[model samples]
Target chain A: MILHGYFRSSAAWRVRIALGLKGLTARQVSRHLRKGEQAAPDHLALNPQGLVPTLEVAGQGALTQSLAVLEWLDETQPGPRLLPADAWGRARVRALAQIIACDIHPIQNLRVLQYLKREMGQEQPAIDAWARHWIATGLAAFEARLAEPAAGRFCHGDVPGMADLCLVPQLGNARRFGCDLSPYPRILAVEAACRALPAFMAAAPEAQPDAE
Target chain B: MILHGYFRSSAAWRVRIALGLKGLTARQVSRHLRKGEQAAPDHLALNPQGLVPTLEVAGQGALTQSLAVLEWLDETQPGPRLLPADAWGRARVRALAQIIACDIHPIQNLRVLQYLKREMGQEQPAIDAWARHWIATGLAAFEARLAEPAAGRFCHGDVPGMADLCLVPQLGNARRFGCDLSPYPRILAVEAACRALPAFMAAAPEAQPDAE
Candidate 1:
C-alpha cells in the first residue's frame, strides 16, 4: 500500500493514526499542499476531491476520505479496532469525529484560508480569527461530549478509536494556531491520553517525514 | 425509529432519503433549525454534536452524523445497501459522499453562515459568495469524479445510495445560492436523475411539513 498525503493535512493525519493503531505500514508520498500538488493531474486521478490522504492499497484502489479509509482498514485488517463494538457506540464515536472533521476542520483547511485571502480578501487578523473561532466553538462542544459517561480514557471506550484519532489531530491544529486550550478540559485530557499512546504521537504532523 | 431533525437541514435530508431507500420510516420531530430549536437543551442531550438528523431506533440509541447514521442503517436494516459490496467501490462511493458532506456542505451550513455575520461581520454578499465558491469548487471535482467509468445513473453503479443522498441536497443548496451549474454537467445530470426519484422528491426540504 502507498499513502499520498501532505504533512499538515488533518485528514491524512487521521489515516496515519488509524494505520499505526492497526500496525500497518505503507510507503509514503507527500504532495505539497501549498504548492498545489494535490490539484495536479496525477493527484486528482488518485483522488478527484484533490485532497490529502488518498491511500492506494495493493488491490483495493486509491481510497480517499480519511474516515472511509479508516473504516475500510478496520474491516480488512486485524488488530486493535478503531471503533466500538456495538452499533450505538459506533454512532457516538462517529458523531464525535464529525464534530471535528465536518464542523471544525473543514472550515479551517489551508485552501479555504488561502481563498479567504486571495479571493475574498479577508485580512490576516480576520482570517486567523475565523480559524480560531471555529476551532474554539467546535472543541467546546466536543469537550462537553467527552464528559459524558460513555467516554472512557479515550474518546469512546478505553481503546483509542475513530473519535480519538480525529480529536488528537484537531487539537494538534488548535495548538498550532495558538488557540486557548484551557476552556476544553475534557478534550485537553483526552488529547493528553492520546499523546501517551504511540499511535497518536506518531501521527502528529510534525512527527511525519514531510514535516517542515 | 425516530429522527429529530429540521426539514431544511441537508444533513437531516440525507437520513430521510436513506430511510426511504431502506423502506423504513422514522417517527419524525422537527427541531426547526431556522428558529434555533436545535440548540435546545433536550436536543443537545440526545446529540452532543447539536446537529440534526439524529436517528433513534426503538431498541438502539440515537445515531448522529449523516454518513455514520446511513452506514448503521445499512448494517442493521436488511434492504438496499447504501454502500457498495466491494471495498474499492465502497471507497469510491464514500469519497463521493465526503466531497459533499465533509467538504461542500459543512462550510456553507446555516450556523457557519450565521457566524460569518455575527462574529466576522461579513456582509451578506460576501457570505453568499463564500457559499457559492465552496459549492462550485467541490461540485467541479465531484463532476470530474463522476466522469469516471464508475459513475452510472447514480454516483456509483445505477443505484441511488449514500453518495446520491448527499449529492441532491448539495445541488439544492447550490441552486438556492444561485450558483452556476453549467460547469458541472455530470453533477447536474446526476442531480436531475436523483430528483426524478420519488424517494428523493419526498425527502426534499420543500416537501416537509415545516418547510416554511
Candidate 2:
C-alpha cells in the first residue's frame, strides 16, 4: 500500500491513525500541499479532487476522501474496528465524526483560508478568527455529544473508534490555530485518551516523515 | 418518522431522496433556516449542531447528519440499497459523495455565506462568487471521477446510489447560484438520470411542504 499525503493535512492524519490502529503500514508518498504538489497532473489522476491521503491499496485502486478511506480500511483490514458493531451505534459514531470532518474542517481547511486571504482580501487575524470560530463552535457541539451516555473512555465506548479518530486530528488543528479549549473538557479528555494509544500517538502531524 | 429540515437544505434533500427510494415517508417538520429556527433550544437538544435534516425514528432517537442518517436508513430499513455491495465499490461511491458533502456543500452552506456577508462584510455578489467557485471546482472533479471505468450511467453503476444522492442536490445549488454547468457534461447527464427517478423528483425542495 502507498499513501499519498501531506504531513500537516488533518485528513491525512486521520488515515495515518487508522493505519496504525489496523497495524498496517503503507509506503509514504508525500505531497507538499504548500508547494501545490497535490495538484500535479499525476496526483490529480489518482484523486480527481487532488487531495491528500489517497490510499493505493495492493489491487483495490486509490481511495480518496479521508472518511471513505478510513471506513474502507476498517472494512477490509483486520484490527481494532473503527466503527461500532450495531446500526444505531454506527450512526452515532459517524455523526460525531462528520461533525468534525463535514461541518468543521471543510470550512477552515488550507484552500478556504487561502481563498479568504487572497480572494476576499482578509487579514491573518480575520482568517485565524474564522478558523477558531468554526473549531470552537463544532467542538462545543462535539463536547455535548460526548456528554451523552453512549460515550465511554473514547467517543463511542471504551475503545477508540471513528469519532475519536476525527476528534484527535481536529483538536490538533484547533490547537494550531490557537482556539480556546477550556470549554470542551469532554473532547479534550477523549483526545488525551486517544493520544495514549500508539495509533494516535504515531499519527500526529509532527511525527510524520514530511513534517518540517 | 419525522424529519426536522429546511426545504432548501441540500443535506436534508439527500435524506428525503433516500427515504423515498426506501419507500418510507416521514412527517415534515420544517425548520426555517433563514429565520434561525434550527438553532432553537428544542432543535438544539435533538441536534447539537442545530442543522438538518434530523430524522426522528420510531425507536432510534434523533439521527443527525445527512450522510449518517442516510446510511442508518439504508442499514435498518428495507429498500433499494443506496451503497454498493462491494467494499471497494462502496468506497468509490462514498468518496464521490464526500467530495460534495464534505468538500463542497459545507463551505457554501447558508451559515457560511452568512458569515461571509455579515462578519466579513462581503456583498451578495462576492458570496455568490464563493459559492460558484467551490461548486464549479468540486463538480469538475466529480465529472472526472465519473469518467472512470467504475462509473456507469450513475456514479457507481447503473444504479442511482449514494453519490447520485449528493450530486443532484449539489447541481441544484449550483444552478441556483447561477454557476455555468457546461463544463461538467457527465455530471449533468448523471443528474438527468437521477432526476428521472420518482424518488429524486419527489425529494425536490420545491415539492416539500415548507418550500415557500
Candidate 3:
C-alpha cells in the first residue's frame, strides 16, 4: 500500500496511528498540503476530494477519508481492534471519533483557514482565533463525553480504539492553534495513556518521515 | 426510540432517512435550532455537543452524530444493510459519505453560518457565497467519485446506502445556498434515484412535522 499524506495533517496522523496500531506498513508519499500538491491531477484521480491521506491498497483502489480507511484496516487487518466488538460500544467510539473528524477538524482545517484569509480578507490573528474557538468548543464536548461511565483508559473502556486515534491527532491541532487544553483533564489523561504506547509514539507528526 | 431533532437540519434528515430505510420508527421531538433549543441543558445532557439527531435508544442511552447513529442502526436493526458486506466496498461508500459528512456539511452548517454573521461580522451575501463555495467543491469531488466504475444506481452499488443518505440531504443544503447543481450530473442522478424511494420521500425536510 502507498499512503498519500502530509506530515502535519491531523487526518493523515489518524491514518498513521491506525496503520501502526494494526501493525501494517505502507509506503509513504507526501502530498505537501501547504503547497497544494494534493490538488494535482494525479492525486485528484486517486482522491477526488484532494485530501490527505488516501490509502492506496494493492488489489483494491485508493481509499479516501481517514475514518473510512481506519475502519477498513480494523476490519481487514490482523492487529489490535480499533473498535469494540459490541454494537453500542462501536457506536460510542465512532461518535467520539466523529466529534473530532466531522465537527472540529473540517471547520478549522488549512483550506478553511486559507479561505478566511484570502477570500474573506481576515487577518491572521482572527483566523487563529477562529481555529481556537472551534477546537475549544469541540474539545469541551469531547471532555464532557470522556467523563461518562463508558470512558476509561482511552476514549472508550480500558483499550485505546478508534476514538483515541482521532482524539490524539486533534489534540495535536488544538495545541498548535494555542487552544488551552487545561479544561480537558480527562482528555489529557487519555492522551497520556495513548502517548505511552509505541504505536502512538511512532505515529506522531514529528516522527513522520516528511516532518520538517 | 426517540429522535431529538430539528426539521431542516441535514444531519437529522440523514438519520430520519436511515430509520425509514431500516423500517424502524422513532418518536420525534423537535429541538428548534433557530431558537437555540439545541444548546438547552436538556439537549446537551443527551448530546454534549448539543447537536441534533440524538437517537435516544431504549436502554442504550442517546446516540449522537448522524453517521454513528446510522452505523448503529445498520449494525443492530433488522433491515437492508446500510453498508456493504465487503470491507473494500464499505470503505468506498464510507469515504464517499465522509466527503460530505466531514469535508462539506460541517463547514457550512447553521452554527458555522451563525458564527460567520455574529462572530466574524460577515454579511449575509458573503456567508451565502461561502456556503455555496464549499457545497460546490464537495459536490464536484462527489461527482468525480460517482463517475468511477464502482458507482451504480446509488453511490456504491445498485442500492442506496450510507453515502446516498448523506448525499441527498447535502443536496438540499446545496440548493438552499444556490449552488449550481448542473456541474454534478452524477450526483443529481443518484439523488433522483434516492428520492424515488418512499423512504427518502418520507424523510424529506418538508415531510417532517416540525418543518416551518
lDDT of 2 at A9: 92
- Which one is best on lDDT? 3
lDDT of 3 by residue, A1-212 (tens): 99999989999999999889888889999999999999999999899889999999987789999999999999999989999999999999999999999999999999999999999999999999999999999999999999999999999999989999999999999989999999999999999999999999999999989999
Candidate 3 segments exceeding 4 Å error: none
* Local error of candidate 2 at residue B186 (angstroms): 0.7
Query: Once superposed on the true structure, which residue ranges of model 1 sit more than 4 Å away at CA?
Result: none
Q: Of 1 and 3, which scores higher on lDDT?
A: 3
Q: In lDDT terms, how accurate is model 3?
A: 0.94
The 10 consecutive residues of candidate 3 chain B with the worst lDDT sum are: B178-187
lDDT value for candidate 2?
Answer: 0.93
Candidate 1 residues B29-82, lDDT tens each? 999887888889988887776789888777656677888898888877888899
Sort candidate 1 into its docking category: medium
lDDT of 3 by residue, B101-158 (tens): 9999999999999998998899999999999999999998999989888899999989
RMSD of each: 1.6, 0.7, 0.7
Instruction: Report the first chain's TM-score for all candidates.
Output: 0.98, 0.99, 0.99
lDDT of 3 at A211: 95
